[model samples]
Target: MHEARSASVPVETRAADYLQAASMTAPLLGSGSQETPAVNTYNSACGELTVLLRSSEGGRLWNHPVTLTGNNSTYHLRLEPASHAVWTPNYFTSFELEQQIKEKLIRKENIHKGVGGALVGVRKVNPPEKFAPPRGITAAVTATLDFHGKDATLALRRPAKQPTATVEGKTRPLAANFSAPMSYYQPPGNLMFVGLLGGFNATKYPAPTGLYFMQPYDPDRIPLVFVHGLFSTPFTWVQTINGLQADPEIRKHYQFWIFAYPTGNPILYSALRLREELAKADQLYPNHKPYIVVGHSMGGMLTN
Candidate 1:
């Protein structure tokens, strides 16, 4: 007889109440008055009320605890000051909290493997935690990937993108996939190479293999491989590759290489083919250090 798989798994749930959208009018408080509080939105399942604050100039101010009064369809809020108030309009029901969590998990998973992809089913689950203010409001986010059916945890930290060079000294904005190559050569040891590999069909017009090199000063170490996500090409890593190349600390450790492929293909098929290509490359340069594969988005999913 075939065994049946267990149906229920515990999921860790975390709640965050943020000011989704709000507008500031003449700040006036009180009931039965023409003035009303600014409205924000949130995601909640149990009909819980969470307070959110907004600044008149713009942006969020603070989040507080409040009770959600009224029926499930429409929520009514009362502020302590009762004067000019900040309210969340139909807050709890309008957001896709679960989907957001799933996307976050998928992004986190890709970071470790140096790839990115979509999140699938949950193998295991845990209880959610209440929202806490993060350290840097404008800082880049760090993602944590906890895979189900496995005891592995992957933490991915991606730096935010800064402005890039303009075209012909003009202020023309550069595309995310601009090409920037930096390479180096090491003497006696294994050669460490790094850079961005252009995707197969990137430009509307035919483009050559775009390889952006980031080699160590010594040049004799095995290079690390960086794989990009779906619909993304080697150009996506231009900023990251450039930063790593410029960092003296990173330069001393290893070389870098970017792998670009046609994102239109199936992820597994691409990965399998990539594995074979890597094998062939390894044969050509036996002394080169083994590659450390990194993929993003769909590429991340493929790595697994």
Candidate 2:
């Protein structure tokens, strides 16, 4: 006998306290059916709280293809954006620094155009790897004006926690896909070569440049900057960051940053440039918390 292949998504099993949409009243398929459980949408406190994600150029994403990934849970994912991750300085554009190092900046995300697409999450059960549920309605709405405020719209652009919505007063854990925003800034495969080339050709690739941010800046959280050694980029810190971020205390109190420099360059020049970048960042974003710099290899000398 062949082992049955399971493709069940982990959904809330508790009593359904929330009102279900009339359309959802249709009887669920029988146990042996091949169909997957459909995405459940219920009435929210806002009557119908919905997520409306779109491209910056005003294109529709409803019909676009998506993939699924996660362990013990199903996450709907779209890899097109991730595959096209950038390596340029302005992976985003326009911060106050261009106009004046003197300008007081609240946060850089306010100046960012946004990274990529959203991660769709499934509750735990099936592997987060390639778990796609099928059959859903699609429609588009045109409005005279958007109802979301500046903060809401801005938050939507930033990489966020599991994509979730509160229905009534209860918070439900929906299926969640991963958020890999840093990958959007610089593709890992190219970092090593870039760091190496930058050392030899100072003109082609400069050292100790653009302060890369992984998230929106907050005055409440202290900044923790990571400096990588020769022939390396912040990509080296991935596992370390993954572990640290797993800690709630670290996540609450610290914001991560990276300083990229040409490793092959003279130590002093690289150090000088690091200092200049830090000073400029301080002038623009004067936070109450002291800066925390961590360095590895040659990056250690400069951090000091």
Models, CA RMSD each: 22.3, 16.8
**Which one is best on TM-score?**
2
lDDT of 2 by residue, 1-304 (tens): 0011111321111101111221232122122112233222221100111122222223232224322122322223221221111111112221111112221211121111111112221111234111111111101110010111111111111122222222122333222112233222334346557767766675556333645655545576788888888777656765566556555467557777777767777889888988887887787676647889999999999978
Off by over 4 Å in 1: 1-219
Task: Give the lDDT of residue 177 in candidate 1.
Answer: 12
Residue range 171-240, candidate 1, lDDT tens digits: 2111111111121111112111111112333333122222222321113544667777755655455456
Give lDDT for model 2.
Answer: 0.38
CA lDDT, every model vs. true structure: 0.29, 0.38
Error of 1 at 112 (Å): 30
After TM-score superposition, the amount by which residue 293's alpha carbon in candidate 1 deviates from its true location, in angstroms, is 1.4
